[model samples]
Target: MERWQRGDGRLIVATNAFGLGIDAPDVRVESGRGGRDGERSEAIVVMPAGRQEELQKKIARAKARTQPWKIQSRVMRPWETKQVEWEKMERFLSGSRCRRIYLDSEMDDRQDRKRCEVGEERCDVCEKDDAMVEDGEARRAAYVEEQRVIQEQAAQAERERQGPWVDSGIDVPSSSRNIPVPSSEVLVPGSVIVTSPQPFTDQDITSSEEEGRPIPQSQCSSVSFDQGFAADHDPVGESRMFEAQKQQRSQQRWRVEADSQREGHEVWNLETRLDSW
Candidate 1:
């Protein structure tokens, strides 16, 4: 493992299900499945490495057994058929041409038909003769710089998209209008400008209740998003709404009901808040 860290030992021999979402940046030896998330990685198969033949025989017998080593049919992602993807895998490991070209041919997944280019991610076979690691490094540096510039441009666009800062339009009284607008049309950062909704005054509340009309843009009773947080004025918060003659009609009704009542009359209140004898 430490040899792998020193950029020497990158030959991983085991084949397992460990490449679904692996994010490691170092080289890996997968089962012909290079980095799925497009991170730079590699895969290798050692033909008759110094290991003994007895180890191979044990693994082969394990594969042929009826125990848990048996290969189960896995569900295909694109379809319901059980597709064994080992044929392409075998071709990629044994082929002598560019590793990328083999993958592109087998997968047929390239946007445009092009071979492995210099300075991009390349395999051991392509870089064996040239040995130009500097090209790949420079390409990565350019990619990082381009992404940073694009990110800054996107941020500027978002700020421009926000446009101008409009006032809440809920009237602020003359006393608290002390904070003047900033010099720049856009709001300056770190400037704490506090505002509140317009409140109903004592005279306004009294007049609204007596006139039997809704308080003009009450800032608490009801919320009106259209006028920027307009609230219905509710004095005393009793939620009382008197009809044009609801009070007069109630008084007259009780008077009629008590036309010839006794000295002590049992009073009952109706749903309309009218008293009856």
Candidate 2:
């Protein structure tokens, strides 16, 4: 005969479903399961004023013959399972301080293993779920750091690979009368200079004259231009600049997909926009 919030209530010393249609403003319901020898209590039935005593006795008897309550257990959601496996994979792949932090969050019973350091408990994802939380978090952090290092190394290598196209302080067209020496160099950074190669027109003419050969009247029919972007020739820094810009666009696209779950956009698409070099 009262009103209360959804889960708050007072103790009821009754026998039949203590809070059946209960709307008490303040109540704390407790079962006498331990105190009594499984005996019925005074609050076992609703004392309806007009009900016959015989009917009430019959209802109580029927209730006593029925089974008791059933309890339900909690289960993990699908996303939770996916996230855990992903973090596990991260821990396996990581190799940095970040990985250590993630691992400290995942495995709890590994205190004896000394898998994680002691003082890393204060990080962002480190505080939850105690020991396992710290382990998993450490693993993720390490994985992230390793992946970052690998990416940086790879990028450095790529730049090195593109080195030959940059200037290397080598003499090009400076020694006009000398026979040009052939270099054994593969492309590396700082090989090619931003300035265009010196024109070979006079050299070509001089060589042709010396060889008693006449210049052809027309350009060759089978020649074609390669429109590829060489990392060195780009005074505008298109390759590096555009690549960074593309990365930003890709991150933005990913964020949008996360929010809306829509398709038709991708990071690789922005990266592969080298049609015009």
Candidate 3:
């Protein structure tokens, strides 16, 4: 076993004595009647029908050998325990119940009713039978899907409860007056300062007011600053600017639809535009 652990042997085939005190993490496959790490390990026990009779005969022989009064008490206790273990093994091998359930019942003293009651995948009996296993798999899949949907719904509810400005404490800006104009120079790495064509000046605002026509909010909204980490330096200003741009676009869309309706033209729809294209 030590040689196998040290990579001297790739495999080892021995009795139950070889497994005791062995702590090899990379031991993938082990075959024997006993000893396990209670992990994803496989234990295959091959017990012939005649083995029970043979074991009983051996126990009888041992008992007869130790029948002398002096050693009877010392030997009898261990032999009795072995007899009980043998009977349990025989019952497990012969039982028609799930192999895993049977093993759990014997090893951990767990009740059969509680073992794998909620869509366990497979066992000796389940693998041999197809219809029952398929039903169990379908139920497990549905249960997993249901749990995922519930989690997603809970996350959506939390986001809705928190609202749009959950991360930043600043409220969403509503108009062009609150929007911050981006500077010409990049203030942070990977930050692009997008400037609009025909920049809005005080003169332009005055001219629009004199003409009795409000300057479309979209003009101010088009100038957005990608400040990146610089936003952390001034979170309030950054959030206000982002919110103002968003509101400007929304208001501009509404105004466009209203203007189209006044002119007796159908509102610009994606399907109509695509059809024309």
TM-score of every candidate relative to the true structure: 0.23, 0.19, 0.31
Q: Tally clashing residue pairs in candidate 3.
A: 0
Poorest 10 consecutive residues of model 3 by lDDT? Answer: 223-232
Specify the poorest-scoring 10-residue window by lDDT in model 1: 162-171
**TM-score computed on alpha carbons, candidate 3:** 0.31
Name the runs in model 2 displaced over 4 angstroms.
1-128, 166-264, 267-277
In candidate 1 the C-alpha lDDT for residue 213 amounts to: 95
Better-scoring candidate (TM-score), 1 or 3 = 3
lDDT of 1 by residue, 1-277 (tens): 4565576875544436545555556544353456666665544456665342444454456458885644455645644332335434444554344677766665657645344686566566676634656677889999999999999999889657533322132334333244333342344468865444556789988998999997675433333434354345454332232332355457657877776463224332242356333
Number of the top-ranking candidate, with lDDT as the measure: 3
Candidate 1 stretches greater than 4 Å from native: 1-14, 21-42, 49-84, 105-108, 111-114, 127-277
Q: Write the per-residue lDDT of candidate 2 for residues 224-251, one digit (tens) a residue.
A: 2223222223335646655655665677
